[model samples]
Target: MKNIKFLIAGILFGIILSKTQVVSWYRIYEMFKFQSFHMYGVIGSAVLIGIVIIQLFKKGIIKDYLGNQINVKDKKKGFIRTLVGGSIFGLGWALSGACPGPMYVLIGQGALSVIIVLFGAMIGAFIYGVLSKKLPN
Candidate 1:
């Protein structure tokens, strides 16, 4: 299948996340408690890498699978929205011990408990979708 590559890429990413311990609840706890630099360092590296990739996209150095230049949209400034949304996300991550991305990895690693977190995330996303129109733009 043409989509097999994407599945492979996802598996690779999951392996990296697992091996780096980025998906570890202990690492997450350390990050929240400011008790260790491991997670912070990983996050900082990711931010730096994201900045570079975004710049590449903006400069037309990156292209989609269809060979079209990737479009980068300017984000609208919203401090209150960001604060509230980030706080909620952080609370969920702290309590669930896994970010949404790693929820699948947790499951793959035999953490059936993460099904509860995945369910909660899905429900939250659905609620947000329903309320998005009513919320601030």
Candidate 2:
């Protein structure tokens, strides 16, 4: 019952993404090629919103649904690790035209092709899980 709110929010978010063409492979491709500002604008706005939300959390201005204190951990700056991880993520996004969340939305919108991307993502996650202990922190 209480989870209905989350479902509604998810639906709204998917609708917005679909309407804004954020789920479109063409838009993603244009962004990657620097041929369009549409995707970059959307991503920039999201990053700004995220920064604001994180700052609010850090200042204790917002609480969880249960009203508990929310703690934002400071991430360690590791240039090499971040470079490697970001490169892998960017490569996957460039190839698939959608990240994980948007991949689900694309599937819901009847894009069956994204299922292959989702399957590959699942396999990658499984491999990461298997190799996590052997990999660096």
lDDT of each: 0.94, 0.92
Give the C-alpha miss distance for residue 95 in model 2, angstroms: 0.9
Candidate achieving the largest lDDT? 1
lDDT, candidate 1, 24-134, per-residue tens: 999999999999999999989999999999999899998877799988999989999999999999999999999988999999999999999999999999999999999
Clashes of 2: 0
| Candidate 1 ranges with C-alpha deviation above 4 Å | none
Tell me each candidate's TM-score. 0.97, 0.94
Model 2: clashing residue pairs? Answer: none
Range of the 10 consecutive residues with the lowest summed lDDT in candidate 1:
62-71
